[model samples]
Target chain A: MEYIQIANSTPMWIAAGVAIALVMFQALIFARKSYNTGKTIGMTDTQMKSAMKSAMITSVGPSLVILTGLLSLLVTVGGPMAWMRLSFIGSVMFELMAVGFGAEAVGVNLGAGDAMTQVAFASAVWTMILGSIGWIVFSTLTADKMASVQDRFLKGDTSLLKIIPVAAMLGSFGSLVSGHLVALNKNTVAAISGGLIMAIVVQLAEKKELKWLKEWGLAIALFGGMIVAAIL
Target chain B: MSDKRRVYEKDYLPYIVRYGKATGWLAVALSFGPAVVLAVIYGVLPPSAAVFAAFIAMASAVGINWFVEPISYFPIIGVAGTYLAFISGNISNLRIPAAAIAQKVAGVEPGTTEGNIVATLGMAVSVVINIAILTIGVFAGNSILVRLPEHILEAFDYLLPALFGAIFVQFALMRLKLAPIALGIALSLTLAVNAGWFNFLPGRPTYLITLGAVFGTIAIATSMHKREARRD
Candidate 1:
């Protein structure tokens, strides 16, 4: 009857599996739809496959990071919910913080021995759910609308409109990089090395028509950047 | 409208909108279900008041991110990706970078319809592969993590900066002039925020830095693009 037992229960695992299945189903359908749409719009199979390959490789390192985070969540919230949340709709940091807040509200501490009563478990669940509800609800309401709103502003030549996304990419990414740059830690070394390596690799890829190298460009930069930072 | 835009915006987008809204609500329901199921089984649902308190605490902590992240991210990921990314979570670390690499390998630009399609497909592949990795890790493969050396684990701390560095370089190389401006604006604002100059603001300083970088870079870059086109 322990709450932790319920957390790692067979029913919990079923729910987790079902939830992850839903996510995978949606992804499959979207991929199929996009692939078909791409064919109509002049995308070759090679290009689409290469994009998929690049994404798969780029995802491996970060996904491993998430997996490492999963180890922590396993101890805190048990395996099922942690697996479901990370697989479907939540990040490690948000879930961990919510669990902490929920535990505190009930005068119990998390990961501080077995103070997790049934109510404490429910409280944590409620906080995680309600906390993240805003995103799904907001997207339900606004995801469709935002794109058209963007399209409205970008009504001119579509070619010229390309600048909008490019600038947004730089701007969003610039903010991310700038944070590390100002921190002046190993992160600065990591970021600079990644950027510098990318600059060189890309120049070489284009100049020499290194298709294989170009395809693996970001993955190389990612690990290379980290190795440089680690050595420093 | 251009042929490409017309196909995406007119012919294809409505279908995405339909799928997005339908599945978005389903995701909300699925995500919220586990808490209720566990509570009902234990017959120890936290009292409504306690649940409300936990909800309030979480909302206050991350409420702004719920609204802001989707909007900021929509530009790069586009419509299908908006639904897919928000529903699946891990938007910044996994999804956006997945899209970026896919576009790079496929020789597509981020803003165009083609890039959007490529990004969507790439993200779909990433989620599938990511889930496969997590499934193994949770069930029987976290042995993979426990055996790693301490220094190797330390490398992951730099993963974010390294990934960001590479992505920023890609977009910056495309628009060399505007990249520095974005980095400068973001660094100043972020440093100012770090210095406690912006303590009065709501939510994380990241939003301020990102919004500043994105909007500021967009304004300058758009004008520069236009003027260059005019001369040409």
Candidate 2:
């Protein structure tokens, strides 16, 4: 479907340009804000750009590889190949954007905004997947050893794990609802709205301690599943 | 040595561990029967799309846990419940799990952990009903009802949007993020109006639409904030 288009016609130059623009945008904002606040880290723009370039180089490899794997499979088989590619790509980007939204949701719910503000938004999506895999592995294996890692990173606190489930729920919420939208024939809008809903809800749930987070998710799943089945 | 640190460390571990164990167990039990049901349907329904749908459902079920709020176990409930509803004719199959999911989304624990047990029992009962339906749907297939082509089945994707719209609207009203709520509506509407226009988006049209909607809303919100700031 769309994946084939991406794999074939997607100008790496264009994709690379957009990715670089995003990196520069982040660096500029960070630099300006830090300068205005007079809390100079003394790092030069050149250094920052160098670091950003290297980071993108490392991460884009995995992302593109994954993208190829996701898109290519659909074409090989010949069904709605475009749909599958698009869904997979949509899911990845949504996951990336959700970090900001997730942070907002958590902040609203727990008054954890200040802490969230300190979280580096750059490279966040990669960090999250990496972190989660790390946590899952650590938790499942040397549960106690992982405790030390948590303590070290969190400055001797590990209660963040309690919040892990909320984040996971948000991801699923975004993906499935977005999937539903894609299924329902409202592609782009569905992905964006679903992603936003997830981001904001997690924030709302985190701050206000809303109980319906679980409820709405279940409703979406069951009702959505029913609708899927009915149409099929 | 202080109580805060101790609470964050020792006492919290046992509770978190217990909760993790409980959730993990709930997840396994919820999916077991659904997997079996899908297998049966795979044999009987004989749609190529069934494989994709089943893969998505299972992936969404498990993958959702990684990204969304795991504090609530309703994904498990929904996963199990959907299969049960599919198997059984009972509408009640929709109720408890739906309620449970809704409750969690609201940020309230679903009455008690005891609700999980009740949900499981309800689902088990639905499975029995499903078996009965399977018998009827199979025997009555060609002689009893009309059939649609495979391509038309793809349109069922919209159910996700409808479900998300209904749920998110309710959630947004509660949280007071009227802006995002409005964005959700607008995005869904746009997709409905110009589905083909989104084809130009990079990966998937759905995702492009989503990104477009989110950023578009953000721009609008930013301007609104600027206006409010100027007024103040």
Candidate 3:
């Protein structure tokens, strides 16, 4: 009983302190920036609280999923390897969701991909790169069009006509390959192949204009990459 | 609506605000204390059994905090931080010296009791160290939370598809091109069916999944963009 009590009680306090510290630090930094810019935080205290709550809600489920998965996997596997693997998985999960939801938020045709394959380095790097590319390209080539889409999404009136294709494309290629590789215990190759596939697929899809078909082709290549990477 | 008129008034605060300070502290308390207790037990308990017990206790705390509602959210954060502390300690193998010091300072049994007074202090020290490192580690003019080394950063490059895939589900439901969606699915299925074939990559599953997501996103994005251009 004594042992159990100690194990359970102390960490909570410690974590709370850390969380508070983090929150405070970020808030202070932002506040300073706002002051220097001659602009106040737009939200009232109430609005701020609401926003935090909403963000917490949005982020909590995913965080829990990762936590539960991590704890279970840790217990079963135990040690640095498990930690590394779980970290990789968790990072991918968050990145994918951020992209998918972010695309819709902006009303762009930007899509998302698989949750599992995202554990590889390729997924993280490419998403950041492609996301940046999307930001630049859309802003340069179709600023008004993108803004219009963003307004529509913010108004809570998005059309399914635009989203399904995006999701499908995002889901199709490199993620599948990465997921397969990880499950097969080939973490490194998965990362490499996934990255390469992303570069190729993005470039090819952009040029071919047969995006849907290209997505399929990329998917096939991903699988083939796995076979070739794995067998050889 | 005037900027000057906006005072720090609270209209609707979260439960954290409503609960008062002590209650909030209690929430934090309940979540993290158990992990500390478990760490203390690691001393006396056999290595195998100790690890098992520690894991179970940690899981319970994590579970309770994670699945429960906003009312219980704070505790989860607290506990998660604590678990992180324990992991940090375990990985560092900081058991004996820390345990001895804890027993001396708190006048508690080293391996017995819940480590109510002593182990808590010891773990607290560990937490402080962990946080301090994280804090100072954040350099100016660069990422303040750069946890990954260069190698890991390199690894992150591969995870793009996986991240996007996870978000794909949450991508807004809108009018979408069925062709891209269909193609994406077809490709994913093919890869999954022949997952065994992709053994060549270093990171098999992660690679496969990342590959899938990258191509998937590209496929959809390009198709939709082209179609829209055609219409224009």
Candidate 4:
């Protein structure tokens, strides 16, 4: 059978499907648990639903952005693996590089179509699997401990407690921004343009009482950044 | 903290941690599904040497991040969220923005119990939504994606920077003063790295800038907030 045929085989689909289904099942369970817990914490019906709605909307653009990279993965690994991988821990760059490393090990260059032997494909798959295992292992071992650490912090003074999350978020975002602003490239334009757009839109929404605008802020900012990057 | 909040520490978080551990370990195991099938069923194993080479390459590139990134994201993501985000991945580009927007619209601050509930809930929603979109994009995407204008597809590249910029602003706007501080620290660190000051570091030291920016901003801003409170 052709390599692509096997790549898109029913068995591969089933393998991919089961992993994805587990993720979906876990998500549903967590979401429900959170909703029940939210009620106890004073997250009202309106707040819960609205947050979900806002998240749902916010996810659309980025999710679509994930999709835009799908073509590369599809050609590289076929539909099922691409679907499973991208839907889970796989980023486009990582997957591509892992595959390249795998193919290179077997002495293949990852050129267009049929250049990938079964052994090379196998190598790529193994590389991706073994390569990403550290995260899962490290996270599983330490997640509960990490949760405990958070517990200690939560018990700290109320005034300081409030400041930690806010400051952490600001710093996290600052680091993200610096990554893009490393040089004056399209990314810089996108970040600056997007930030400017977000500021304007948010201010306008607040002043004009445009609740819908507030909800759609991320989508608007993402698209605005994309447009500016494309233009400039 | 009030009794309402106490219930979170006493009742809610414990269950999430326990459940998260069980499911998180399960995900680690399940992540190996496709690779096993490719190896066992297809008899497509590569040479052990080739596999080792791939391992070296993969590890050299992103190994430290497998552990480092998750721990850094703990403050914003919370307990349940750490489980879900790490398992499902795409924490920055997709998950964080989703959770941030949800909390923003709902007017909940991160680090607090209520914020954790909302952030986790929001992230859970994002995981399901992301997979759903990818599912569709995989089966039907290629035909449609190929037909879309190249210019539009090119536009997708900019969404990430736009997202980072907009999200930083979203959180930065809340605290106001820390915005410039975080940005400045991140920029200096990034520039210093670019100038080869940190070449002695292993793998990619630029990655550590995210940590520095996050922890540095947290320390600086928390002190500022406390100092101002004392003055008041």
Candidate 5:
């Protein structure tokens, strides 16, 4: 069979579907367990329901972004592999580079017409699989250990424990924002606009105690900033 | 620890760890299974040399982040959330934000059992939503994207920057003083790198800059926190 035919084959779809189903199953299991745990911990059903609603709303913009990424990947890797990879461990940012490295190793430019052979495509798949396995391996081996590590770090000061995670988030996000802001392009504009928008929305939400504003703040900032940058 | 907290750590966490281990191994298999299937059907395996090169290239690019992310994000999302987020992908873009927003709206502080449960619920909902959108995108294929106006595609480019910016502000508001300090460190390092002032540093300076910002802010914040405690 031709490379393109194999890329979008029925068998590939089945394999991809099975992989996706496993992920969904894992998520459902975890969610159910956590929900039961929440009840034991004295969390109200209203809290759980509100959290689910807020999370669903928060996911819309990012999901749309992932969709954009999927569209781009589909053109290169076809529907099945792209769908499966993106749904499974392949982040939108990392998948392209993994595919690129694989294609380059086989002396082909990915997404170029007739350049990617069956061998090259196989190489790309292998690279994608191999490259991401480290995350699973490291996390599997060490995730349980983190609970103890956090415990040791806390040294009985639970308040300090909260600060550490909050600081980590701040630092990581600060660095990410800086990377985009340095470019002085539309990206920088978007970043600034988005930050400003979020600041305003958060302020309003806090001052008014508006649950809806807090829920929709990120999405509003993201789309609003993007629109503003595009216009400018 | 309180009896409830102890019970959680002793019983619930062990359960989470067990399930996490099982799911982690299963995820590894599922991730690799697709590549194996494609290789067998196509009657082509990537050459040893190609595999080696692709692995090295791809691994070098993401290796550090693979280790760093789980550690950084563990406290915010908890054990079960980490397992699911890492496997499902989109930790930063989708899962983390969803969890964060959910916890916030539910009025649960992160790093607690209730927080972890809320985060898990949020992540599960986000995962389902992401998969649904992706499946739609896959079935729709390129036609939807192909027919999109150029300006809309252009706007998509700003989405990530906007997202990072908004998320940064959310965290920054939590630590008003330290946030700017971290942002300043990252921004300065980013500028220096762009100016070719960091020629001596190996690889993209962005990684180093990010690390520096995170540690630097932590140091500053910790000292300030300690001083405030002493004063109190």
Candidate 6:
């Protein structure tokens, strides 16, 4: 069978499906555990439901972006491989590099139809898997220790504890937004518009006590900016 | 420590650690299993050396992030959230924002046990939403994607910048005075990189610029916060 056919084969689907299923199972287990723990820690049902709603709402725009990435990957690597990798543990940026390295290892260019063979595809799969292992290994080995490190850093200074996460978030987001802003393109436009929209929505939500605006602020800003950029 | 907080930790941390380790290891195995199955079926395993070479090449590019990201994000998401977010992937683009927004909506302070649980719940919800969307996109194939209008597809390119901008503003609102200073540093660094002022730096200078901006903002914000606390 041709390599492309093999890339989209039933066996590949089964393998990918199993991987994806395991992730879903893991999520389910963790969600249940966290929910029970939240209740024990005095979290109200309203808070839990609100958190779940906000999370779902916030995810829609990013998920659309991920789907766009998947579309590009599907054309390059076929459906099953792209689906499995993206759904399981891969991001758009990392998968592209790993797949490229895989193809390069077999002396082929990815997305070049006739160049990719079964052997090259296999090599690419191996490269993608191996390349990403460091993250999993490092995360698994140090996760507990890292938590301990954080605890030691706190030293029971509960008053200042809140600032740590908030500062981390501000710094992280500042860097990310500035990267986009400096592009001086539609990205710049989108980013500025999005930021402005969010600021307005949040201000309104707080002052007017418009609960729904707060809930949908991010989504509105994201899509609104995209629309503004497109129009411009 | 509050008795409730102590009990929650004593009772919950053990289960989280055990299950997190179990699932994390399982995820790693699952990640590699597909490639092994493909190799056996095709009987075309690439040279081990070649695979290693390709892995090294790819890892060299992104390996630093494997360590940096988990640590940088640990304070915001907590241990359980980190485990789930890292395993499930898409931390910056999706999980972190989801966790952050959920915590905000639930009025839970981050770095607290309640905050950890809420963040975990948010991440799990996002995983489910992300998986569901990817599943639909995969199963539907390009039929749906290809039908998207050209303008809409163009707009999708702006989604990420917009999302990041929205996220930045959400956090920036919390510390109005600090936001501009952080933004100024990030913008200046990005402009310097873009203008080729950092030509001496190796690889993409954007990363260095980003790190500078993040840490610089954190330092400035921390000092300002400290000064305010002292005055109070």
Candidate 6: where are CA atoms >4 Å away?
A111-114, B195-202
| Top DockQ hit | 4
Question: Clashes per prediction?
Answer: 0, 59, 112, 0, 0, 0
DockQ of 1: 0.75
Question: Model 1, A1-232: lDDT tens per residue?
Answer: 8888888888778877887888898899899888988999888999998888888888998888888888778877788888888887679999999888887678677657647787788788878888887988887788888867886876755665678778888888998898899989999999999999999988999999887887788889989999999998
Worst ten-residue run, lDDT, model 3 chain A?
A: A116-125
Could you tell me which 10 consecutive residues in candidate 1 chain B have the lowest summed lDDT?
B36-45
* lDDT digits (tens) for residues B24-127 of candidate 4: 78887787788888877787779999999999999989998887788888777877887888888899998898888888778788877778788888899999
Better of 3 and 5 by TM-score: 5
The reply for model 1, stretches above 4 Å from the true place, is A111-114
Calculate each model's fnat, 2 decimals.
0.78, 0.03, 0.05, 0.81, 0.74, 0.72
For residues A10-44, write the lDDT of model 3, one tens digit per residue.
34235334433532332233223222221232323
Q: What are the DockQ scores of the candidates, in order?
A: 0.75, 0.03, 0.04, 0.78, 0.71, 0.71
Off by over 4 Å in 3: A1-51, A67-169, A172-232, B1-169, B178-193
lDDT of 6 by residue, A178-232 (tens): 8887778999999999989988998888899876776777788889988898899
Cα lDDT tens digits, model 5, B1-232, are: 7866876788777888898899889888888766877877667787989999999998777788778777766766767777888888888788988888888888887666677778888999999999989999899888889899888888988988898899889888878887888898888877887888877755565667667776677667777888988999
DockQ measured for candidate 3: 0.04
Quote the positional error of residue B148 for candidate 2 in Å. 8.3
TM-score of chain A of each: 0.93, 0.22, 0.25, 0.92, 0.93, 0.94
Score chain B of candidate 4 by TM-score: 0.95
**TM per prediction:** 0.96, 0.28, 0.28, 0.96, 0.95, 0.95
Candidate 2: TM-score of chain A is 0.22
Could you report the Cα RMSD, in angstroms, for every candidate shown?
1.7, 22.7, 23.8, 1.8, 1.9, 1.9
Ranking by DockQ: 4, 1, 5, 6, 3, 2
